[model samples]
Target chain A: MAKGFVAITAERCKGCGFCVEFCPTRVLALSSAFNSKGYHPPHIVSAEKCSGCDLCGMYCPDFAIFGGRYAR
Target chain B: MNEATLEIPYEIPEGARNPVEPFLRMDRMPHIWCAGCGIGTTVNCFTRALLDSKANLDKVAIVSGIGCTGRVAGYARLDSFHTTHGRAIPFATGLKLANPELQVVVYSGDGDLFAIGGNHFIHAARRNMDLKVICVNNMIYAMTGGQTAPTTPATAITATSPYGVSEPTFNLVALAEAAGASYVARWTTYHVKQLARSMEEVLKKKGFCFIEVISPCPTLYQRRNKMGDGLDAMKDYKAKSKVRNGAPTGECTLSKTGEIVVGKFVDRERPDYLELLKAQMIESLGDRYVEPEEACCSEC
Candidate 1:
């Protein structure tokens, strides 16, 4: 059961830094390690510290992040 | 097969198709751009970047102001805005705020960004808005019949500048970096691959990203300056340009014989403006619709 609807789709993420920049609670962090696309991907740097704020999900240019299925 | 006059037939790989096509309407080949213009190459680089990044097509939005480059937004197969002269930044700003999920990009000529909408450009960078701006610097204003522009080299002949305009040109990359843009880069049309890679980098960057492409305006600037064809302009760029990476930020000056330093000019981290505003909105109105500014005034 996925309690928190907010999650990052690693394959779709392009490491554009939007999530990291827009996260109001500083919940998202871009890993130095590259994904399958040879580019960095965003991660849940402090998931335990997340407030379910959904800022990262809302600001992502790609639909890489989803939150509560109420994405903008 | 005879060694002296053998003709070889080559076929393109079926899987390795040209990505620019389908996205581009080749029937529209030889666009209205003047001979020796770099706009074609610039447009090619952009489309290539889009393909290389593999960004979500439906989630992209291209915005532009009035100029040769401004016409680019209309050609792209994405949600595009053919905005007013020198006002693409504000329009893009609105679009980004309304839906930050869209990849909003502003593609405009130097005059549009540096002269008419200079203030908006500065403030947009200062706010660190989550957007990408690709400004094509062809020195003189080409579309409006070749007039002197902020990027026009001093003493350059133009319809408006008869005895070599006395005014100095603007260093756009430096301006954006100083204004707080999180990502900034400068490249010439000669460096197609480099420009494409830079565009991809900026597309993935978090905050406001600014890229200045030194393109050629052969019909306008070249004819007036006797700079020959667009290829000649590229040759000039290669000869005159001095590649400088991570240069210190300050007032940008162009010396006659020195390098025209171009590279990843700036990359930094900053909180984007829209998210901050969103947080402020949630605190104030509890997710209600905020009234938009009515008039095109300073109050907005």
Candidate 2:
């Protein structure tokens, strides 16, 4: 398993793309699919590379995306 | 190229909840902030700060004035008061005075704090009230359809200032420092880590603490100014920002397009309002000055 993972609630996303743009590992990208808000929520591009820093969470203005690491 | 857009098929941990959910009123989710609004980003930083500090939830009171940022009180799960426009500081002052146990926080926008409630802010800071203030500066009055605000940089076109503002912008950090704030710092929404750290620091700090967050108003400010979107604004901040911790507050003036100075400008010790009041009473009244707690209860 990857050291960490990110969970995305697509419906809550407004698609400002802060998470995808600022993700340190470049682990995410805007998906082609649209959410209920008609915005493209981010999808994991490199799941194993996620550092679970939650920088994505801090930058997510919509409160749509957050990351966490499994307990050691 | 096809793989770039493809989502990695992975299962989210069972029962995992977003970290921001607990700090916020989730039923009020899908908040009114427009896509790319940095107010929510500031809220995220605040929640993290609250959690990291492990403050008693019941003792924290979130007070907000009228504006988009004012809605923060409604969305937060803490003791909240959405006061009239520009009155958040006065209301917070009352809360702190009536019940000094509560950690009173005034969360409002630049227009609300610096423009509408500018006088109240200066006096509160002068008294060194035990209040933690978070000012989200989007540079314009966003909710009122983008009117130019006191902090709006020169040459920014807004609904009220089509030809660009002629008046000089207020240096918020300088004002706070001059007005006697015990702690003052400024950060952009893009500087999430630093912002959260400062918020955490303020939670434990006494006297008046102020943090000014320069946020992106993508819907109005950005769109009107021809800045592509909220993401573009973040990229702009990344390219321009300089972290000069403890830089003289007067030199930290924000411009429309210039190097952004951000960091802790002032962190010093000062006696707060309550302490001064207690000292004065003790000196003047001596035995006649009854302690607030020792005063007879209403039931008596």
**Which candidate leads in lDDT?**
2
- Considering every candidate listed, which one attains the maximal DockQ? 2
How close is every model to the real structure, measured as TM-score? Answer: 0.72, 0.96
lDDT of 2 at B6: 43
* Weakest 10 consecutive residues of candidate 1 chain A by summed lDDT: A63-72
lDDT of 2 by residue, B180-207 (tens): 9999999999999999999999999999
Which ten residues in a row are the worst by lDDT in model 2 chain B? Answer: B1-10
Candidate 1 off by > 4 Å: A1-72, B1-8, B13-16, B255-258, B279-300
| Best-fitting candidate, scored by TM-score | 2
Q: What value does the lDDT take at residue B181 in candidate 1?
A: 95
Interface RMSD of 1: 19.3
**Cα lDDT of model 1 by residue, B170-228, tens digit:** 77887888899999888887666678889999888888999888887778988888877
Report, to 2 decimal places, the DockQ of model 1. 0.01
Q: What is the lDDT of residue B61 in candidate 2?
A: 98
